[model samples]
Every structure is written in structure tokens, then in C-alpha cells.
Target: MAFPLQRGLTPQEIEFLSEMEMVTVIPRQRLEGLELLSGPTEKLLPPQRATLPLWLAILLKRQRRVNIVPPHWLHPECLQVILQFETETKEYTDTFSPPPQLPGQRRAGDDSRRQSAAPLRPKYTLDGQRYYPTPPFLPQNTALTPSEASDLEREIALPYHWLEVGNMLLDAASDDLTEPDQVRRLLKDLREVRMSKMRKRVDALDAAAVAGGGVSLTGVGAMEIGEMRGFVAGVVEGLRKIGASREQARREQLAEEGSIQGYTQDDDDMQF
Candidate 1:
């Protein structure tokens, strides 16, 4: 399938949108003015289902006002299946690069493609031996955390260095040959490693900025000016891919209104 363009929103913007993405929720109690107020989607009364922003739903859930419906993918069984597949399967160099189709199956985006639970079979080469890789974890429509949503967007749209890093992280987890009970533990470790790596990169950038008197990373130790330029060029290229335009006016508006506390009613209408 053709992926959507990656441009427009910055990472920060996407995070904000994820928090604002609406989900269908069931209210446990009646809240005043709920039905009258318009949100990202149609408003309804309790104990009825309503579409509310994730942030709001989370807040209400904490207050015992609503129960957020867990997306299908987040189900324990589903997660277990995915984790099992990723663990048992050898890490492939490429998942998106023209995956192999099973007999009686059609290419991706083909009108004849069969809708079946059978997984997409991709081939992997190991020790000069060619083998059909295990079935991949098929993604589905599911509510996701801001981080998960961001990663998904990058996975399908950005397809950058981070994607390779993610795959390698999963591979590392599988290498331990841990039992099923340890899946969550390994995943937690993977997340910590990923976060630490990101933190170091941010720290490095910050240090470079400070050393350069906030002007540029130029003449900062072993860091090359060309590398900094290339980093920026990559960002611009990604933005261009998604047909993103610079919304300087909105950014300026946000800057002027410092420390905004909440989303507006209209903002709740955004879908994940």
C-alpha cells in the first residue's frame, strides 16, 4: 500500500495530535453539559458511548466518569501472539522491500489480495541459507499511546534510521531466548535503551548549541558543519515527502499565548 506523506507536522506536533486524538468511550456516569457540548465527534449522554479526545478520556477514566475501550491490538492475547511471532522469527533485513507472497496470494494493494488471517510470508537469508521467514505481525486498527502512534507514523511514513533501530531492538530482545513470561521485561528494557539513546542525542545537540553560543554547531569539536547541514536537509526532505507547509503563523500564535493549559472543543474532533 502507498503510504501517506510524512511532511507537515513536526514530531512535537504529532505528539500533541496523539493526545488530542478521539476514541470511542463508554461513560459510567452522567456528566452535566456533555450532550450539549460538541467535541471532535458527536456528543452523547451517559451511560452511552461517546467519542472524546484521548486526553479527556484518560482524565475521565481516572475520575471514574468513563471507561476507555481498549483497542483490539492491545488485547493481551493479540499482544502475546505478536510478541511470540517476533521472538520466534529470525530478524529480516527488510520487511517493506517487496515481501514474498504465498501461493494463491496477491501482491500488496492488488485488488485480488485475499483477506485472511494468514500472515504475509517474507523470505530471509541466514548463513547463506535462504528460508521463508515466519509470518509478520499484521497491524490493525487500534488505539495507541502517543509514543506508539508516533512510531507507527514514522514506521510507515518516515522509514528512516529509527525504523532500522526499532527492528534491531526487537531482534536484540529475541536473541536472549527468554520465556514468554519475560516478554514484557525484555520490552521494558528495549524501551529504556531507546529512550537513553534519544536522550543522548538530544544532549549532544544541546551541548553543541551551547558551545557554539546558540548560533550553530559550527566549529564544535569533531562535529562537522556538513553533518549538521545534512541533518537539516533530511528533516526538510521528510517534510517535503508529506507535503508539509511551514505554518509559521500558527507557531507564532502559540508562542504568543504562552503555557496553554487545554484543548478546545473543536480540538477534540481530531481522529487518531
Candidate 2:
């Protein structure tokens, strides 16, 4: 099942080579070119089957193809054949480890998840004053007059505009990143979109809470994560066991209700 780490070959080709040994050998004639590319396995298909990649059709041709694969070029896991061959040198053994999590990432059963999703209680004032659509530093009537130049900003003349300040809250959806839905949402607030939404929602809210936010609720969510993770594990195990039990009962029911094609009248009366 070894894949050859051949130069000029794609990772995809190498992956295919690994899979070949698990089922069948590729035929040399088929491997000659793309004209005869064939079955993932030979025993499963017919000869008249259209040709495939030259290496892939080797089984149909029934001819052995010799490839002087380098010791290091072959992946260790797939090269079971190399271990049996004598006078082969051993390379470094590759060991696998679970993937590392990002810093402050929440593992399963992070208790704080339930807590973080909970909405925050906003503050009442920002330095003994009521909240306003226009903060103190912002210019009065910061509207863009029709007489202004065409390129002038149509948005509030606030110093901390979202387009420049950046949003740490939103996620990107497009590959090019030109489509920011969060930015669109920010542009639609009452102040920006003229719907008068600020006072309605932030009336009693703490302004300080908004300014001094970003206390991660999900970071150490699983802080005491030790056995709490087992809660999620238990749920998965329960579902698996339930599925197995259901499958077993279904098979049993099918076996018990075997074909009744040749049953006599008495047998019919004594149904399964």
C-alpha cells in the first residue's frame, strides 16, 4: 500500500498509489498513458471497460511492471513490501499526534459557552452623561451636504469609523473578502440608516460595557475541562449505543419475518 513520493507528481497521484495496494495492482498497459485508465480494482470490472491511466490499468493487462522505487521515496505506512525485502535501510519512524488547538480556544463541554452566549448587561452612562448618537468629539450636524464633492463620505463624520477601525466580531464569507456582511449591518443602524434604533436598545444599557468589552467568554470556557469533556463523550456514546441497538432490533425483526412464499394454511395461521 505504499505510495511513491515521485518528483513532479501531485499529492493526489501519491494518494492513489497508496490506495492501489489495498485492493489490486495497476496494469502496466493501462498505466502506459491516460488512454486506458481503468478500475480502482480489476476483479470488480470487465476488460472491455474503457482504458484509464497507464498505471491504473496494469491488472487488466496481467503483465507485471517493474518500478525501481527509492527507499525514501516510498511512504512508510504503504510500503509493507519494503519491510520484507532484505538489505533495506530503515529511515526515521514517523509518529502522529492530535492537532494542536489555537490559543484560548474552547474545547468541548466548555461551561462558559452557555455563559458567554448570555447577553451582557450594559452600563448606564459614559462619565456622568447620557448616551447620544453623536459622541462629544464628533462634529455637529455631521451630514454630508449635497453641495459637497462627489467622493465625500456619506457616513457619520465620527473619528472611529468602522471601515477604518475594523470589526473583531464578524466572520468572512467570501474568498476575496470583498463581501463583509458585518460592515453592512453596521451601516444600517439607526444613526447610519436613519431608523432611530440607538435610544430604543441602549436606553438603560451601560456605555462602559460597550467600550470596555472583549472579555473572552469562550476562552477558558472548558477551564476545569478535565472530566467535563466526558459529558459530550457520554452523549456521543449514548447515541452510538442507541443506533447499534436499533440496527440489531431491525435485523432481528427482518430475520423473524422471513419469506412466506411457500407457507401452508396452518403455517400462515401460525405467523411469525
Candidate 3:
């Protein structure tokens, strides 16, 4: 059997990748840790929350063994705040809201006293080599405890896998989420707003394709990028072809002018 080739990642593939993201889950039963390929999961004990891969969490949730704790940004209040920032904020009117800060990144408006104390802890691999993690390994979708959530310094921006993780949790663990209906609605609204913003960037694609130029995709989610990849790529390719045509015409015009000047100089020399 032959399958048609696709340009960018399909939505299902993006969702599959999101499944590797770590998320917090509250277990209802005790289970011993099992060693698996992507590192052994901690033994899940009742009343003691553990962070596990989203796929495993979803499996346990479906089996009625655990409840997935939605990340703080998945809450309705936070979504409303993010939506407002997207629609109403003057500073972000032309750009998407910023993504979550990486470790040790200092947010704007931080006090000098507090800025010096930001932590940058690196994770260790099974081989004991230290390396900083990003995206799926960053715990961006993991639920924070009450004390940790109380910190006002935590920014409520969306993570890189926002859409996929949000949709997955909403599908498999809606009961665990606060106001799942509202969360779903807000997710839809956010998607529409961001997609509109993405489509509006068509005019800037030409400039982006030029040397030393680029369009900022800092806060775009994987699913969103997959959706827009084909259209944006086509537009950029067309722009590049048009640019090449113009450059070729300009070079021919200069060459013609140089040849004419050379012919005139030769005639002057002949007369002399």
C-alpha cells in the first residue's frame, strides 16, 4: 500500500509527540515503579502526586487509577487572562503573547533584588551528564502544588505544546479539570484568535524570506505550526521566485548599460 506524502507533521503525529510530555497525576491506588525505556516512573502512591508522561497518565486515568491534574494555565481564569492579553493589550497587539520563560530567564520589570536570585537548575541523564531540558521535558504542563502556585512570579503564558496537551487532557480527564466546558470554550477561542493572527502574517512572508530576515514564531504551538506550514511555505516560495526574477532583470539592465558605455568609449577612441 502506498500513502501520499505530506509536507509537515500531521496533527496526529503532533499529538503523539505531545504524549511524551510530563504531567502531574494524582493516583487513587498504590503501584510499584516499573522500568521502561524513557526512564522509570516513580512508584505511584495514593494521595501522593507524581509526575508521569502524559500517555501513561492518560492510560491510568482511563483505567480509573489516577486523576490528571490540569496545569495552571489550563484553568479558565488563566485562559481568560491570556485571551484578554491577546485581544486587548497594546504591547502585544501586534505580536502573540510570550511563551513560558526558560530556566533562569528574567522577565521584564523584575526588581533588581529579585533578579539576582533566579535559579537555573540543570537535569541529569541516566549517564549522569548534566544538560538543560526544553519543551516536552521542561514540566511545562505539570500541575503545580498549592504552595508553588502561590508564587506571583509564575507567568501564565502558554507552553509550546499548549494545544495538543490541552486537547488531550480535556478529552481523557475532563472530570479532573475545573469547569471543563469553560476550558474547552476558551481553548477554542484562543485557537481562533491565534490562527487569525497567523494568517495575517502573509504580508510579512516576503520580508521574512529575504536575507537576514525572519518572522518571529516564538509562541506558536506545534499543531498550529503544522496547520499553517503549507500555506506559509507556498507564500514564501512564491515570494522568493518573484524576488529572483526581479534580481535577474536588474542584473540584465546593468549589463546592458555597461555594454552601451563600452561601445561609446570604443567609438570615441576610433575617432581620436
Worst 10 residues of 1 by lDDT: 217-226
- Residue 177, candidate 3: alpha-carbon lDDT: 96
Give the range where candidate 2 is weakest over 10 consecutive residues by summed lDDT: 66-75
Q: What digit string (tens of lDDT, one per residue) describes model 1 on residues 21-43?
A: 44556777866544323223445
lDDT for position 189 in model 3: 99
User: What's each prediction's TM-score?
Assistant: 0.35, 0.17, 0.90
- Give the Å error, residue 130, model 1: 46
Give the runs in model 2 whose Cα sits over 4 Å from its true position.
Answer: 1-220, 224-227, 261-272
Residue 249 of model 2 has an lDDT of 100
Best by lDDT: 3
Per-residue alpha-carbon lDDT of model 2 for 1-272, expressed as tens digits?
A: 99865334343443343222211122223333222222242322222223232233233333334111111112222122222221132321111111122223344666773332223233346376653322111221122223532433221121222211112112211121233453334333312321122222223223323354422212111111221334434544565577688889999887766644335555877986
Better of 1 and 2 by TM-score: 1
Tell me the deviation in Å of residue 145 in model 1: 20
Overall local distance difference test of candidate 2: 0.29
